[model samples]
Target: MKARTALLVLIVALLGYLAFFNFSTLAQDVPMSLGFTEVHGPLGLVMLALYALMAAIFLAYVIAMQATWLLEVRAHNKALQAQRELAEKAEISRFTELRGALDDKQTQWEKRVMERLDALENHLKARAEESDNVHAAYLGQLEEQLRNQPGKESPPALGQQ
Candidate 1:
């Protein structure tokens, strides 16, 4: 399935074919020297045995590497998940705090606007009262002047005219 696996299979098939064809040569005895002793053995079989051992060792190493990598990736994923949760909580907290601040500002603005309106209403009422008093005084002076001058039929009173 994988390139390395395919190549390994190819190599193994070629060796099997070679060994099958050369059975006589592989069976012939040859002297082999171990570091501790010397012995006569089938050289081809000995070489095949060594190759098998090396393949087993390589397979074991590959399995170990794959397992270690998987565990490291799992740990990294867990850490990322935790970080994501923390970030979401912080974002929610900021949104809530901002909402509270905006509400407070809106309330303050409403209070200030109401206070301004009340002050303006009071000022307009005072001005209207002052204008009424001034008009009344002018009418009283006109009436007094008419009385002192004796009868020129006095002009009609203010509203009556």
Candidate 2:
């Protein structure tokens, strides 16, 4: 138990022990004033009974308040747990969406790269073919020029040699 509550219990126990041991003194009659009128009663016992009644009422109130607070705490905890779960789910969803987006971007990039490579390959092949044609044309012109020389014997044509 908490220190304060333990102390309160100890005090109540001592008071109860005192009251039990001095029952006769407590029961002795005495004069008392009711706010409205004067009366005679066992003054000590009456005071003790009133104190007990007040203690009982206060204790009941304390117990009820504590019970209400406990219930409120439980409800708040449940609400917090639910919110935490929702946040986790949302985070998971965002991650999944990001993953999908990345996958799509990678796929598009790969496709574009492949297309670019294919275009480049085609362009290179066309350039190589054009170069070969130009080389053949130059060879033909050289052979003709050599054959047409006026005073020099044309050496046997290039490939024939």
Candidate 3:
């Protein structure tokens, strides 16, 4: 695998650097450093090769991790979207049911209102008829009284009354 190869290369370079640099001797500025005796040249090439391999390995790992995390997020988001859609549908259905019930109630209320109005209209018509009959009877009584009054100045002529 590329990852394994890169890891191996990195290890080799790191070891080479340790042998050549001899950090302990360098830090103390010791004469004839251990690194010079141990590494025996070629230090730069060894270190470079190892560092390149390590970089490759780390890059691959990071890319794989990023891809995996991306996929998981996408799947989770999809699931949430599905759930949201279902909830929306349920809410819509509930609203529709409520709307239907309200419509039915409104229709019933309108019917009752119309029926009451009709009853009131009929009652008013009857009352009007009764009033007309009472008025006619009163007129007849007045006419008879006038006729019986004989020659009392002819009971004041028309508009004179």
Candidate 4:
């Protein structure tokens, strides 16, 4: 739509310029009214200047629109990048938290294992001491019985007379 409007404006300006420069030739066929006046020197120059001004204004508008589009695209990309960084940081923090919890569990398990091992060692040592004491008491009783027995006595043969 904008292209068609620009083309129409250009065609109108070209026809006006032709009519202004060759007024006598164009007027030969068409009847002129009292109100119609031919465009002359200063008026034609002013029209041309106005046409140039309109073209410049259109060009400036196009440039401004393009600049605004580029700026908006840059801003969108920056926002996307910031969101990605935030997600990555959140993932890293989650991993760290999980690792810390795992380490804590491992330490607790190790402590419980050491405590059980210490208790088993103490129980076995006590049992060994009890067995040694029982053996010593039995040996003392055997020696006392032997000493109380007689040292000499008459003995009978198989078929004693």
Model number with the top lDDT: 2
User: Which candidate do you rate higher for TM-score, 1 or 4?
Assistant: 1
Model 4 CA lDDT for position 32 = 32
Q: Write the per-residue lDDT of candidate 1 for residues 1-161, one digit (tens) a residue.
A: 99988998999999999999998998899988998999999989989888989989999999999999999999999999999999999999999999999999999999999999999989989988988988888888988787567657777666676
Give the per-residue lDDT digits (tens) of candidate 4, residues 70-148. Answer: 9999999999999999999999999999999999999999989889988988888888888788876665565555545
Candidate lDDT values, in order: 0.91, 0.95, 0.78, 0.74
Model 1 clashing residue pairs (backbone): none
* Candidate 3 local lDDT, 9-119, one digit each (tens): 798688767756875543443233365464344444545577769878988998999999999999999999999999999999999999999999999999999999999
| Clash tally, candidates in order | 0, 0, 0, 0
TM-score of each: 0.69, 0.68, 0.58, 0.48
- Per-residue error at 20 for model 1, in Å? 6.0
Model 2, 77-144: lDDT tens digits are 99999999999999999999999999999999999999999999999999999999999999989999
lDDT order, best first, reads 2, 1, 3, 4
CA displacement after TM-score superposition, residue 66 of candidate 4 (Å): 3.4
Candidate 3 Cα misplacement greater than 4 A, ranges:
1-47, 150-161
True lDDT of residue 46, candidate 2: 90
| TM-score for candidate 1 | 0.69
* Model 2: residue 28 alpha-carbon error in angstroms: 2.0
